[model samples]
Target chain A: MDLRDKYGLLIDDMADMRATVRIQLADGGLEKCDQARNVKEAVQKLSLRRYDLIVCDYNLGQGADGQQLLELLRRRQILPLTTAFLIITGETSYEQVATAAEYAPDDYLLKPFTADALRTRLTRILEKKEALAPLYRHLGPKGDPVQALAVCDELLAQGSRYSLDILRHKGELLQTLNRSQEALALYEGVLQQRATPWATVGKARVLAAGGDDTAAKEQLAGALKAYPNYLAAYDSLAAILEKTDTEAAQAVMEQSLAVAPTTQRQRRVGALALENEDYVRAEEAFKRAVEKDRTGFFKSHDDYAGLARSYSAQGKVQEALATVKDMSQYFAASPALTARQAAVESQVYAKAGNAEAAKAALQKALQTRQGGDLDPATQLEIAQACFTSGSAEQAKDIIRNLAEDHHENDQVLAEAQKVFARAGLGDEGGVFLDATRKRMVKLNNDAVALAKAGELDQAIAMLTEAADRLRNNCQVAINAALALLMNIHRKGMDTSALARAHHYILQARHANPEHPRLEEVASFYRKVAPPGTLILDDE
Target chain B: MDTLLATVIHDAKNGLATLGAWLEQARAQTPSPALEEACRQAQRINTQLVELLALHRGSEGTLRLAIADHDLADFVDDLKAEWLAPPQSTITVSWPADAGRIGAWAFDAYQVKLVLLDVLRNALRHARTTVALRLAVEPGGGIRFTVQDDGPGFPVAHSATMHDQGSGLGLSFARLIAREHRTPNGKHGDIEMKNAPQGGALFSLILP
Candidate 1:
């Protein structure tokens, strides 16, 4: 009696689940299974336990529909390999939506289907999934990527029924291993089978990584031309061009946003347009992103800040101020984000012609940056605000430091050029950029020469001195780490030198995680020094 | 006449599907031969209703399909399982081995399933012993789905007689489905009904 009272609702839910999966066999026989009634309950059940199959209805009454739920499950990697997720749709529109999704359901069942129909389809899907289960099992919760590569190779060689799937998996695994060459060959093989957009995108990425930008660009352009709505081609193409051709990147981004305007894509397009200095487009994009991405986990204060910048640039000072006020409401007060917000606020004030208020806000922004080590991007942001407020000396100092530190970094140099161009010091800024870059290169070269000449300690000493002198310059810091590693190789693990090596590599990594040389140098630390050091093991 | 026919068929389909759903649900809770009979009969009615509606629309040139892609073997299995009860041990599915890699082809998977269901139902009902559903890639470039049965061939005036009651109209609907399957190479699909050389009724949807 108490069980009924406690679990009456649960029993009802179980019954609903049973009905969802109660597919008909021939002669009106029912095969028993379970499914949740709605997306919330489905996600809940899925997270708690993995079912062998899920048959979801397209119209789930309200909230997220089946396709959206399926997308979420795939994106979050919540669905198990053994599970077959099928979406049942009563309308043709759901079919189009399912097809358009990057991660679609295993199969879609049209409505008014008999139970036998569903059972047959489900059986076929489950059998296929079973055949590929070994590959799936290897890539599961406790899986290792290195070991998974071996599994991929074994399955690939054996040539199972899932040979094609295994090949795709191997290609992806190879890419993850940073072995782009092998991945490129596999992707090319797949493209020969079918000009699948995903395979093309993979080929483009491998090409881009290998420094064949022109070929990568041609491949990406062909895919986009064939399937204009394929978001991966647009995104990968935009990402490559974002470094060198901001305007083209922004244009491709806008085209992609038209196909499927996800909030994440919207924020990306906004940032890119802002980078390209297309204020009108940036304002609309950021506003759209902010409106839709309020609850999005990927949403950041940068979205609101970008919107405010666009608004202020367009001379809509009130809207810019309001955008900042809204940003504060969305995010908690952190020193870094707070500082960025104050800088945006000063820009709004300057646009409104409030000299005194702008100066005060600029001072507040500077105070926020004084105690903390602001990132180069943040430094640039604050510097832009300082320049707008006519604090020429402070603005020039910030840009000079940023320019000297990251003169060779494409992303930083591009942004730095914009800053210099905006301040009407365009040609002078180019000359300054050259001089600073030359000086750093000379120092780096001198240190490396000392290391090569077998004066390892002197090289290490010189680099460390230069690292201290030129703060936040990752190129110098990375060189300094290399010198220290060479010193270790020569002197045999001097604790002090090992410690210094750790300090600089960590600093370099923290400065720019995307640096190509980062993992290369850090791997050497593990080779020379013994295990149990935090630096070697931490990596 | 067309308006009345469409309205009645549409309503009947809705009723039959609703009936089929409830009966299937009831059978799951407490299954019986009687409930299964009711469900099967309701399915037949639903199939007839869908056929009538589609045939009428085809005649008026109002029929449109949500053409998408589906795996051929899976599609055949679904038809076999749904339309054949005891699923007939005599009934088997065959396709050229390499045609298995045909993987997925563009078609109106659901509606085409309906057309094949009707054709297969007739074959199963009439077959003496065996019903074979064979899939083969046509010599030129298209795919063919054929339902053959060792059954007494149709009467000489079959279409003339069956057309009166909209039974032959089902064939017309099947033909319409084939024609709607337009390929990028600008070829339209076709359907043929003929007596097999080895003594059987032959029905095929030749799709580009």
Candidate 2:
């Protein structure tokens, strides 16, 4: 209950972090606190007893993350209603968590926090948590979202000071219940009162999920203009752009990194440049990433491969060979890294006109990927190696499978197309490409035709089928999504349809780069979609 | 990091402030020859801190020096009064034996003060008896200041040079301060330390 009683918790993983926090907390008269190092420890401790305040880290190395742990505790009713949970994270990837709505913490804190700042944030969260306990208790575990929304609405209507937070919670709840349109409207209502960046980002999320990436980009861009140093906005904008404009995407990432350069962003930008064949930039970015975050768990032979590729491109064959050979000197014997080194070796050998050496290198890389513990990106890179080594047929199959599987994803589609084009399977690529285009068009027209003929069920059926078949096709996705939106609009004009249509439309635009209708449809989506579902303008 | 540098300067200044406080406290509590020596050591540290801060300011182009005209006789009189107040020391004034040459002149007041302070310190250190100062005008439209002490004179060839000195930065600092004034040939002003013909150390400043 008191600040002095909070620091005695036996959390080992973040002892340094705890010490730092303790120093600051001591300034605030807080001590004797309980702590959790990981999900298992946290859960085990929670099972025995409930702490008044639970300060948790989002990433716990392995198993359940902070959010997942929160969900588990909340779902099992092991966590006391009186206990407050605070999440901390180095990353700004809050939206990337698939079940974000399911395990929302009481409040989250960003890193590099000072004592005074942390104290201020914790004090506010404590105040709010106390105020909302009654409603939280009434809702209980496995609470009804509609009922929760009503409670939040009642609080907002009463003009509570916690209205913004309540509105956010309400929207998140709506998002969970698949009532994104209503949630979007609520978010927009909050935005109209003030230019809140998080609310704007929330709206962009709805737009992105509803399939309107252009709208999402626009919203994110607007937010970024106001909050240039806000890393989350840049990250969201970068995510949208990564599907279409690699150069613009890289620039946004670089800008973000310049403000608060992270190891992950550096690695991501480096890998993207490598894919784009901008080897020198990739190498430099990777080198900076390596030098900056020595403890980053995401380390790979990619840095070496990147440098190797850069050197090969620069016509320094010997240096390229030397760099790859030297990676083994420092790192442990990693088969995946060996594969990466082999891929680079093959490229170097091929550049040097040594076919036999290239083949041998390619075989080693193939062997590495076959060891079955490679990360997804590494697997993609290995697939790329296969294509580069004149195995077009094998590359075609790999890409086609990945494309069909992540068919609804714009970034994945672009990546798939790039791989196919790289393998010289342009005609086969065209068939898949043209078929996707024709199929999307037909699917859209079929759903529209079904809706116009007063066959609503058939229209819904047509859309559902289209959704299943060309899950990644933006046109079909948007059309099918639009049908559902129309259906929902007819049933009292709810905003959920708008959210869905927007998300699907964005996806479509991403899949078909330079599509003339992208901007037009996006503008239309903005008009019909719920206010919170509109992403900020890019330009 | 810029904040870190600022903090360092702040800490150093605070150290000097604390030393001053301790010196004052000691002066009241105990009076001994050894304690006087301790006080002088503390004063040296304080002076070093002041010079360091000035150097910092000079590097930043923020060191302020007011330029004004003052009679050489009045300037020497004011310095003599300050010297007489504390540890009294004998002083003598020498000129071209004429009044017209040792007239009023204008230069940076702070640099002039620093030059006089350095010469006075050197005089106090080595002059056991009397120190002499000479003021004159060069053949051109320039002014010259010369300080000579009655202690051992400096070595010939090396002592006349600018940078080569046992004290390291003080001589260089005096010369650097002198460069702010310009000569008639458009070169900056110059300062040099050497063995006076009579005895002891001699410091000279030539100003345009």
Candidate 3:
């Protein structure tokens, strides 16, 4: 069907720009079109009718920007695959836009365009869409990436000007499929034919995904040598250096920010600086992020917290306190943020030897935790602050609870260990950890011994008791249950046992992903589980 | 009318030439794709041509920013529709994610469309499949558009004496129009060209 016959919506803040675009579309034979001045008007129009295409400005006074509008539309499943959404932008730096691409849009129109040009681009996009309609349809409601790749392969074979796009899509699909080698090879093949930053970045992504930071950095370096302004290259290079070299990573982030200083990138740089303990740089970067986000959608309480963190670390206690108050004014809606500010305030008060004020701040923090789950990381920090203020018992209880709740989390465990060490309770913490581990292992070992002795009922009872006692030891619980179930429910694969195992494994995975033993347990459950069913064996 | 049209055209062309010259200088002093020159060439041509064309229409009292129900993707597609790159030269443009057919944007839609097309044409003529376009709308209030090619970007040496050689008028035109549409917040739209790290020229446009 022709696009002119399809209804569409056009949204722009400027009347002139809107009129200009409207005429251009008429010239291109698009007959049914409506216009809105901003996102609010656009939303009204959107609710009233379905449009085949949407032309929107990035900035619309109040409500949501074009990206957020699109995200909201997608979130609500309001826009369909057949519907086209285009964003109008006037940004010089791609960094901000790069983050937007993570959400995905159909097309972008830079300002100062002509009618003829718009016609040509729109026609091209329409034809390409028609070509990939089958794939689009099959990918279903929100878009299944794997199926999209398979469909792209068919379109690629059809041969067109968009083969590069198809190839890139295929590479992305392959990457998603965990076929990193194939994805890398595909990206490399594209690079061999022509040096494109996208292809180079694609290769770097593969390398990074493959756990080869050095190769990814090398590829990024080569690309940068050829095309220094390719922003993706800088981002990829920075990501690669992030883990191994904090100084280098900060330098890369700084360089990237110098080229295109977006609020998000600035925040990232600040957060990284804080991580690297570069308090001065962190303070500067966080301030810039706060300044930038103050007037844009990038506004986030995280930036405020980051600024507070930087100031606090630098011993600018009053400045930090003031920053939190400013944050409170804008972030009154976020209880967690209030809690964070309180935690920071308590630190400041404690440092100043104002015990009463510190206590009050801590109490405020506890109040914030009353109705909801505090983020574990934040809770850990508050607990640490409490311990430093001679509330060692409270700290001990907090760590103990956290350790038990996330028994499989090595990272959290290590962090908890450090916290304990700092609180002068390292030996006690270590002993607690050792005892917990021994208890879990002994539970499993005892069940195994009972099962081997031909006392199936006793073995099952022992496992049941063990599972009850070590409720948070997901891995052990799954194994012990499986062993008993293997002896008792050998009729035709124990569905109950499999279900329970899967639940424990899933929770364990959430707590400590990519564990070496996870896949083995999964396979075991798969071998003896019912088809198309899941069990929540988590305690 | 002719004088005004010519003046606008001249300004755009000169802007492109100057940009090309600067790029050449940058290329000679630096290494590789000489991106600044290439970007100048792309922006000048795209922006200037639109300005001149608009002016030409204005003189005749027909100057208007067209808005209608057009397939935005089709417009971008038409700019560089030919996919089969010549044996020795190639131009590859893909919509790795949906071939960019799910959305459309309105502005001086036609001018921006041509800016993308003109860029592709230049890449095809000067380089080959080295051309790629990435179009998206940011959560902020603007659109992000990118065009790139895998061929070695603008020749650095020739760029220095831009008016002396194949001085790029296309990029200049694009940039001029973009600048005109620039917002008072110093956020006017901009067109930038550079070399792709893998090996090509890239032109990026940010419009608000």
| Deviation of model 3 at A429, angstroms | 12
Q: Comparing 1 and 3 by lDDT, which wins?
A: 1
For model 1, residues B111-208, the per-residue Cα lDDT tens digits are: 88888777777777677777777788777767888888887755556733342245566676688778866542246789877788777778888976
Q: How much is B61 displaced in model 2, in angstroms?
A: 22
Chain A TM-score of model 2 comes to 0.57
Regions more than 4 Å wrong, model 2: A1-123, A127-161, A169-180, A204-218, A275-277, A300-304, A322-338, A368-374, A408-411, A421-539, B1-208
After superposition, which runs of candidate 1 have C-alpha atoms over 4 Å from their true positions?
A1-97, A102-155, A169-185, A204-229, A237-255, A269-282, A373-377, A390-453, A462-486, A502-527, A531-539, B1-20, B26-90, B94-208
lDDT per residue as tens, model 2, A1-539: 34565533333366687677667667876766666677667767777765767777666664446666676677567877667677766412332332123345755555545565556556656666776765575344334455676788788788665555666677777776567788789878765443444677788888887889988888887766544455677778887887678788888888776655555678778867776778788878877866654433345666767667777776889988988897787678877777778877887887788878988988888777767545434555666767777786665555554554345455666655665665666567768755654555565677788898877667877776665555445556556656665676566455555556656775665555333335455555555555555562542
lDDT (0-100) at residue B70 of candidate 2? 43
TM-score of each: 0.67, 0.46, 0.58
Q: DockQ ranking from best to worst?
A: 1, 3, 2
Clashes of 1: 2
Query: What are the Cα lDDT values of the candidates?
Result: 0.71, 0.63, 0.65
Instruction: Give DockQ for candidates 1 onward, in order.
Output: 0.13, 0.01, 0.04
State which candidate has the highest lDDT. 1
Candidate 3 C-alpha lDDT tens digits along B1-208: 2466656665666576566667767777884544754754565454555555654544564333322123346555554443334344444555434434524333455556656665665666655544566876645555667776666675666542232125445656566546434321234567766666777666677764
If you assessed candidate 3 against the hidden native complex, which CAPRI class would it receive?
Answer: incorrect
Candidate 1 is scored at a TM of 0.67
Against the true structure, what is model 1's DockQ? Answer: 0.13
Candidate 3 residues lying further than 4 Å off, grouped into runs, are A4-7, A23-35, A39-52, A58-83, A88-105, A110-117, A133-163, A332-334, A380-539, B1-208
Task: State how far residue A424 of model 2 sits from its true place (Å).
Answer: 6.3
